[model samples]
Target: MTEEKGSMLQSVIHPTAIIDPQAKIGPNVKIGPYAVIGPNVTIGEGTEIMSHVTIDGWTTIGEYCRFFPCASIGSEPQDLKFTGEKSFVIIGDRSIFREYVTVSRATGEGEETRIGNDCLFQASTHIAHNCIVGNNVIMSNCAGLAGHVIVEDRVVIGGIAGVHQFVKLGRNCMIGGLAKVVQDIPPFVIADGQPARCVGLNSVGLSRAGVSEEVRRELKKAFRLLYRSGLNLRQAIAEMEQELDSSEEVEHFLRFLRNADRGICRGTKE
Candidate 1:
């Protein structure tokens, strides 16, 4: 057990719980039976760690979060070369880690694994180390993240999807269940299949989200250049640059495509 020195440690711990005296627990927090809070753990105000859960080292969780039964957070990265570096898991407020969800600590020394606010991780989901997860994301049951993946805001990942390491899923993207996501998924699209392909734009989603019609038209045109024109990527991007004026949404899409380390999912099969 490490030393705890903070305004935390003022929280309520169940009598049945085994929290290290060294762990820093915040105000109005609850710890359930047989829950083990290891050293260097800092749980924020109004959070709850349920029964049989284990929160390990160097973990920092924000306020109003909930961890269900058997959820394991801040465990060491599963990467083979990890020699117990001082990696951290930083979680923001109002997030839910459901039953059996496991979020590993960072893989690089002194590096941080980050999860933004209002995200939901359903049962048995695994977020590997060094992953950057943005706000309002929902990952369904049995969805797993490999090391260093980046998931942008407002994305909904379907059940049992396996995201490849370093793959990035752009904002507002939807992936179908059981898909093997080996490439990057750009923003505002629906991707599905064994090897994922961009099936169509997420029109219904955008409509429900209250996106403007003009923006939708711009996105539609952009999509046409990228997916429907049959032009190669460079040619398509060049054409889009020539034809479409810069808008925030278009710029985001272009930047996503430009910065793709793992290539974007194609509209058609090879």
Candidate 2:
């Protein structure tokens, strides 16, 4: 049910919810029992903030999103260098934050902790300061990402996985359960183990995403060249360029390799 409070048409807010008067709440939004919305927060239409969810700071949540019970968004950064600078947590549409998930705001002034559309952050997942999470990403239960981490589109982080600070997880990469990611992961790769070694191409994920078989074959060839061929990094890249026909997938892989400042994750053999 909805209510009209004076001139403003208020959305359905439970009686126990504490929403600051300065907060901008769109139509059809639902603030559940005991949920707290801070002054500078803006929740878009059709979003639901469940019981005991706390959304504070300068957070902006998009339409059709859901925050489960006890989820904490726009919380202060854990970094010691954060000195109350103005930062934001921006979430895109159709994302779901499961129970106890925590997303912290950025540390630097005017920076943002951004999450793209259609992402699912499972229970107890933690996204640290200044992280950029791309569309359709899934973080399983208890996954944790440190400050400045970048998770690209369609990536799946397994349960209890821990990604270190400043690491870049490339598109369609699958990180195994309990993996410790300390380096950059290139696109379409399956990484697992303690230090997260690249096992092989993410064939299942590619197939599920409707990637053409021809592209998969080329990626497999590139993977073999990079991991199995005993050649050095430069040699492998050169071989891939010379042997493989140019395609979007090949270009993306090469570009990721070229720009990886923290170094790419190596295979078990390497």
Model 1 per-residue lDDT tens digits across residues 110-198: 99889999999999999999999999999999999999999998999999999999999988889999989999998889999889889
Give residue 141's error in model 2 in angstroms.
Answer: 0.3
TM-score of each: 0.94, 0.97
Candidate with maximal TM-score: 2
- Candidate 1 lDDT score at position 216: 82
Judged by whole-model lDDT over C-alpha atoms, candidate 1 comes out at: 0.89
Compared with the true structure, all predictions reach lDDT values of: 0.89, 0.94
For model 1, the superposed segments whose C-alpha errors exceed 4 Å read 1-10
